[model samples]
Target chain A: MGPLIPYDIIPFEWSSIIAIIIGLCFGFILEASGFSSSRKLAGVFYGYDFAVFKVFFTAAIVSLIGLLYMDYLGHIDISMLYIHPTYLWGAIIGGAIMGIGFIAGGFCPGTSLSAVAIGKIDAIINVLGIMVGVFIFSELYPLFEPIYNGYFYGNITLEDSLGINPYWFVFILTIVAIIMFAVTDMIRKRVKKVFY
Target chain B: MVNRKLVKFLSLRYKILAFIFIVLAGGLVLLPKHEKQEGISPEKLLANTINPERYISTDALAEKMINQDPSLLLIDVRNESDYKKYTLTNAINIPLKNILDEESEPYLNQDAYDVILFSNDHFHADQAWILCTRLGYKNLHVLNGGINSWYNTIINPKMPTEDMAHTEFELYAFRKAASMYFGVAYPEKVKKATVIKPVTKPSITAAPKKVIVKKKKKKLPIEGGC
Candidate 1:
């Protein structure tokens, strides 16, 4: 009775339309929240504005809580949701590269698109850079295959990997996030303010 | 004054974080530990389908078929060739791979019939049963020894020993008559060699094969996701 598209409760034809609607709404929300500005995004690195951290972390926690509660109430079967299959080194190395890229470029893929929607020339260039990176990686896949396919752990949730109860993990995460938020605020005060 | 200023400096963002933290902490303390068992755990599905009630014995299926029970639906899960060679009367051929197809869903997922799935042995039928059970389909039963048992008991029943109970003999006699009704020559008649030669050969021999071939062509096992 849940996961409508996967369960065929909603016809397959509507999937593209639904995806477009969701994507548009997501972009609109991001743009409205001033994510189009690279300075605001870079603030997370520089310890100036923490909008990036606050927004992203809040969204994650909110969705985490919503999904868990929805699953508990039997409105949706949480188990059916796809977990990204973990390739340990690939994730660590790829994430490190992305983190470096994020600090340097001040735009991740999604925020770059939102910036592009508002006609930011830098974001347009950033998107081109991402495309080129993707193209280069695809062309050189054989060279990177070892790292890409190495340490193949199946799709697993935090609880599965850590052997902790999901509720306790969520509670711990929430506390950690709260402490980070406080720390970020203090750091933002100490850092010299840069107006964007 | 510094403490009040500090409190005032904690903006809407911090307020939201504080609120979420308190809620999460409360939830963790009060709520029972939610075990995050990912994706309809295979172990649980195995346990669910392992129930004895999940199987319909060959004898019970034979009785239901003999009665021409409208609520009984037999599903042959063998390959097309095997199903064409021999299958139960009125059984729908939903080969193992096609059991989850949209076409077969109407048959397997419905409660209107006591849907009994069978293959050559219990192997394929149990596989189908596990699949249907995992997908949360109810009212499905596996044919306990599948068509192999059906043939052994119903199509060519063994006569009871002399010392067997009257009820056992009665059941065997009923099975013998059912075998005759289905046009299977008894072992005793086959041993006589010439006794059932005329009775066993006819258009009745070609009818099942033809029907199965036609059904196989119509239900050409569509590829479906598990």
Candidate 2:
């Protein structure tokens, strides 16, 4: 029956309000889970903690399974859901930059925003740096345009390109995530613990 | 001893995690996959089909054309050959067979225009209408009686007898004016015999011809450039 906005079940005017509510909930969850703590977040990179990995992987699998179940029960139209388009080189370079940023700043965009809400000086600097980066990117858009727009692949799903059955793919992915979680926990136990 | 060791290896938390994964995986594997339905359900389609509101009568269609309603989009659903031979002014040809094709989607699956489908008769037009209707297309209507009705009513209308009701006479007069608007030429005798004031021809200007100027293709830098 959904997406509610596209189907007009929920009017388009309500989208921004709905998005704000979801964003608030996300920030609250991140803060509650100690994600706003730079030391806690950075622990994942240093191998002292695997909370991020466990939480994110659990969230992914839970949402995947839940959406599939909803689709099967005729509650939602899975095909109508938006898929972020793949821009091959753009994604590769952007991800590398993001990964480096995460390591250096000890907080990704969302967690940094959560930290900023609690008046963390480092998070405020990080957010300012993010805005500066965005401004620079916009100013020099033409320079980045080629790589950014190149190798454009239209909105596609894993099932589309890989020719895999969605159910089987999700099942295998869930198993893999479970294995990774257990491995991360073992690695965390062996590593020297760093306390904030 | 093996059971006790297994219990020790898998703690209560792991046990719960494993249980959740197993249940999810079981549901995924056991649930029957239903193929995505192409269009509206049969029940909805049936209800829509029986609705008479979907048909725009020839007179109403003619009236729209005379008024040059911007929202009205006439679709000639006959074959390409027939379309080429004869079609309504500004009407786009989309044969019934190609009604569901990707190329026709921009024309049919839009809310901006009230697209009316018509063939020689109601048959092909009705078929196109049904196909589009099933796909949940909005603002679609079948031109009742199609082009055949248009020709009979607008292009060559029957004059009302002297004893006919005033409304019938008025309708006949309107159709005569519409026929002239569509460039239908009546005999001089018939034209002069009308007691009503002469209907002035609508001023229609020829569309400006398109002039094509091909530009030289410029080669750009290869992709993945810094």
* Local distance difference test, each candidate: 0.81, 0.85
Candidate 2 lDDT, B58-149, residue by residue in tens: 89998999899999999999999999998898999999989999999999999999999999998899899999999989999999998899
User: What's the distance in Å from true for residue B10, model 2?
Assistant: 9.0
- In model 1, which runs have C-alpha deviations exceeding 4 angstroms? B1-13, B32-141, B144-226
TM-scores for all predictions: 0.59, 0.74
* Least accurate 10 contiguous residues by lDDT in model 2 chain A: A73-82
Error of 1 at B38 (Å): 13
* Model 1, position B162: C-alpha lDDT score: 54
Compose the digit string of candidate 1's lDDT tens values, residues A1-196: 4778776779989999999999999999999999989999999888899998998997898788777777776667777677899999999999999998888888999999999999999999999999999999999999999999998899977789789977777778888888888898899999997879
What TM-score does chain A reach in every model?
0.95, 0.98
For model 2, residues A1-196, the per-residue Cα lDDT tens digits are 7778876889999999999999999999999999999888888899998888789988888889989988887778887788899899999999999899898999999999999999999999999999999999999999999999999999978899999988889888988887887788889999987778
Name every residue pair that clashes in candidate 1: none
Q: C-alpha displacement of B116 in model 2, angstroms?
A: 2.3
lDDT minimum window of 10 residues, candidate 2 chain B:
B207-216
